[model samples]
Target: MAHHFTAYEVEELLPELKASLGLRRFIDEEGNEVQKVPLGPEPLMRMYITMVRARILDEWLLRLQRVGKVALHAPNVGQEAAAAGSAMALREEDWLFPSYRELAAYIARGMNEEEILDRAMANIDDPLRGSEFVVYGHRKYNIVPAPVPVGSQVPLAVGAAMAAKILGHSVVTMAIFGDGATSRADFHAGLNFAGVFRAPVVFVIQNNAWAISMPSRRQTAAKTFALKGVAYGVPGVRVDGNDVIAVYTTASEAVERARAGEGPTLLEAVTYRLGPHTTADDPDRYRPREEAKAMEKFDPIRRLGKYLKARGIISEKEEREIWSEWGERIERIVKRCYEKPPLPPSVVLENVYSEPTWNLEEQMRELEESLEVMKELGIGVE
Candidate 1:
C-alpha cells in the first residue's frame, strides 16, 4: 500500500468528530408526530406484529427462567425496534449473523416461536442436540449459529460476504451485536477485513448501552460506536435504534450499497435494554433509578404504536387483538414445552453424522440392547 494519504482517508484522522446524527425518530414517545411514518399500514403493522411477539415471548422466557422451566435467557425487552427494523431491511436472500439477545431479529427473520421455545427448553425435539444456545440459526434462513463468545460471530459474517462476492451473488450479510461487542477482538479483525476488501456486509451495533454491567461510557472513548468504523474506511451512521423507520432506512441503504458491490457500512442504533443482561443477572444493582425512569418514555413499541395510530394505520382495538392473539399462542407453546422432555440420549449419537459411523452404530445398538435388558429386569432407564 502507498504511504500517500488521500483527502477522504484524512477525514478519519481529524481529532474532533461530530457526535451522533442525533436520535432519528419518527414519533416521540407521547404519541406525537416527529416525522412522517415511513411505511403504510400493512408494512408498519408487520413490524408492529413482530415487536409484540418478541416482547411477549421475551416476558414469558424470563418467567420460565424464574420458575426453572428453562435454565437461562437473554431478554430483549426494550430493543425490539433495533432488531426488527434492521432485520426487515434485508431481502430473503440475504444472510444474518446475530448475537444472543437479537431474538427479536431472529423472530423477524421468520424463526417460529415453537422452535424458539424448543431451543430454550433444550428438549428432545430441538435440532442440533439442543447444544445450540438460545442464539439460533437455520441454513434455510441463511442464519449461522451464534457462537456464544461475544463478538466472535463478526468474522463469519465477513467471510460470508467475501464468499458472496467471489461467487458473484448479490447478497449482503448483516452482523448484529451489542454495544460491548465493539470493544472485542473479532469486532476489530472482522470490520478491518471487511473494510479492506469492501465486502457487502452491514455491521448493526445494537447500542442498547450495557454489556452486562458495563455502561457505554466504560466501553469506549469515542462519542459514537459508528465512528469506530470510519477508521477502517467503512461508512458510519448513527441512528435512533428505537425508531423503526430510522433503523430500516439506514439499514436498507447499507444493504443496497453492499448488493451494488460497494463495501461494508457500520450502524450504531442508539437504544436501551430495559431488562437484565440475561435472566441470570440482576440489573437493579448497576442501573440508576433516574436513567431507567427517563428511558421509559422512549420505549420502542409505544413510540411506534403512536406513529401507527396517528397515521390511521392501526387502532387501539386492533393492537389489543394482536396482543390477545400472541398471548394465546405463547400459552399453547408454554404448555407444550412443559410436556416435552430433553433430547433423548440416542439423538446425540445420531446427530453427529448424517449416517452414524460404524463404531457409533455398534455403540448405539449395544446401548439399546442394554436398555431393553435393564427394562425387562425391572431396572429404571434413568
Candidate 2:
C-alpha cells in the first residue's frame, strides 16, 4: 500500500487533520444547533455588542486608510470574534500582550475610541505621539507595547507572567498573535520558559491561516498549531475563533487554570483574515477573490446575529438602532480627531529622557532657531 498521500488525499481521508485546526462551534453557520450555548442571554448580548462594534470600526477604518485619512491599518475583519471574545474573558489587571492586528481586543479592553482615532490620525492628543504607530500600546490599561516583528510580544508576555508569579500576583498574561508568529524564535522561547517555570500565561494564536501572502501550509506542516505546545510541555486546545462564546469559554478556562498555578495553555484560535495582511498588502496579488467571498458565509458577526435573532434576544429594528448609535459615536470621535491640531515639534524632546541630554538640547536649540526663522517667514509647521 502507498504510504504517502497527496494534499487532496489527506483531505479526503482525515479532513479534520488539515493544516488548520478543525473548526469547533456551538452553533453551525446555518443557525442550526451543534452544542449547548456557551453563554447566557446577558453575556451573549454583551459579546454581540462588542463584536458588532469591532466589525463596524474595522470597516470604517479600512475606508479611512483607503482614502488616506488614516496612515495605515491592518483590518481584523473576519477575526473580530476571537479578539473580542478572548479580551472579554480576561479579568481586570490581567495584562494583554497583542500583536499589531488586535484592534478588536483593545476595544474590548475599554480603550477609548477618541485615543484610538487620534493615534490613527497621528494627532497631538495621541498618547503614543507617533513613537508607536497605529493602536500599538496603552500602558494605562496594562496592554504591553506591541512590537512590529511578529511574536516579539510573546517573550514580553512571558516575562510579565514570570513577574506575576514572583510578586504573588494572580494575573495571567495573555499574548495574542497570528499563526505565522509561531515560527519565530521568541514564540518557542516564550512558551518553553513559561512551561518550565509554569508561568501564568495563555498563548492565543489567532490562526488566520495566512502569513502575509503565505498560506499556513508554508508556515508549518503540523496537524494543528495547538499541538505545537506539546513540544514545550504545555497543554493546548483548538477553539472556533469565529464563535465568540467558544473563544471566551476556552480563554476563560485557560486563564483560570493559570491563576490557579496550573501553568500555561496554548490556545490556537481557528479563524480567517478576510482582508489584506495590512494596508500595504494586496490579497488580490495571490489569493482569489472568490475564495475570500466564500468566507463571507461563515462571518463571525453574521453568525452571532443569526443566533441572536433565532433566540429572540435581538430584533432587526433593535439591531439597526444599535448600529445607528455606534455610527453617531464614531462620527463624533472622528470629527474630534480631525479638528485636533498636531503636537508642537518641541514635544518630542519630553519623553526621551529624565532630563534633556546635551545632544537633545542642542537639537532642540537648532529646531527652535529653525522654527523662529520659519515664523519670520510666516511658514506654519506644527
Candidate 3:
C-alpha cells in the first residue's frame, strides 16, 4: 500500500529549524559576530534609554509598594525586551493592547512619566483616576489603557484589529500577555477568533518561566508555547526573548504580516523573570535563587549593551553617563510621585460611569456626606 502525505501531515513530519532565522544581530557576548542582529546607532541608543527607563520605573514602583504608598505592584524587571522591542516595532498610528505589567510598552508608546507615576501614587491628578481603574489612555499616541484582569486584553485587541480591517486602515494591534495567560480560555478564544477573521493582531506572550509561583512546565504540557498557534492555523514563532534584536525582528515581521492582511501571528518570547513577581511575592519560596542568578547571564540589557559597544554605537564612558542620567531622572520622578497629594474624595466618583447612574449618584452622595462628617470631626482625608 502506498500512502500519500497531505500538506498538513508533511508539515508535521518536517524537521524543526533553529529559531535564529529572520533575526538581526551586531555582536555577541564574546565580542564576535556570531549571527547577530544589527541596529543603527540612533535606534540602539533609544532602545538602551527605553530599557533603562522601564527598569527604573519598575524599581520605583516596587519601593512605593513596600512603603505602603501603593496597594499593589507587578514588576516587569526582566521582561523589558519583550515589551520595549515589540512596542518600538509599532507604527505611530497602531494600537497596543497591554497587559498589567507593560510599563515599558506604555513608556515606549509615549506615555509621560508623570502620567505613569500619578497612577502609581494614586494622586488626584492621576490620568487613570488614581488606579480606581486600569485603562490609561493617551489618545494622541494610540496606546490603549492597560487592563489588569489576566487575558482580558486579548479579545479587545482582536476587536480593535477587526475594526481596523473594516475601516480599511493599515494599523496593527499588538496584544501583550504573560505565559500564565496562555492557559486561560480567553487566550484560546482570542487566537481562534483572530485567526478565523484574519484580524490584524499580534499575540505576544512573554514566557518568563513562571506564572507567579507556578512553573512554565506546569502551565502547559505542550513542548512549546508557540505551538499553540498551530491549532488556530496561524504562524507561531518562538524567539530568544533576551535577544533584543531577535525580539524586535520577530515582532516586526508579525506586525508587517498583519498589516498586509495576511493574518494574526503568535510570538512566544522565552525570557526569565529576575525579580519576584511583585513586591508582595517571595521568589525564594518557589524557585531557586541559583536559577534566577543563572538567568542573569543572558540579560537582554547587557546583551544589547555589548552589541552596541562592539559596534561603536556606545562606549563605556557613554554607558556610564547614560546610567547616571537615568538615575537622576528616576529619582526626580519618584520624588514627585511621593510629594503629590492623594486623590480627593470627590474623584472616586468622577469616572465611575460615563453618565452617572442613579445608584452611582446615591453612592457619590453618601461618600460626600461621609467626608463632610469627617471634616466636622476635624479629620482630614489622606
**Residue pairs with backbone atoms closer than 3 Å in model 2 (clashes):** none
Off by over 4 Å in 3: 1-9, 12-32, 132-137, 377-382
Using lDDT as the measure, which candidate wins? 1
What does candidate 2's lDDT look like per residue over 43-67, in tens digits?
A: 8888888877777777778888878
Which residue runs of candidate 2 sit more than 4 Å off their true CA positions?
1-22, 374-382
Model 3: ten consecutive residues of lowest lDDT: 15-24
- TM-score, one value per model: 0.89, 0.91, 0.91
Q: Each candidate's lDDT (Cα)?
A: 0.85, 0.84, 0.81
Candidates sorted by lDDT, best first: 1, 2, 3
Per-residue lDDT of candidate 3, residues 268-367 (tens digit): 8888888887777899998999999988887778878887787888899998888889889888978877898877767767776789999889998899
After TM-score superposition, the amount by which residue 365's alpha carbon in candidate 3 deviates from its true location, in angstroms, is: 2.1
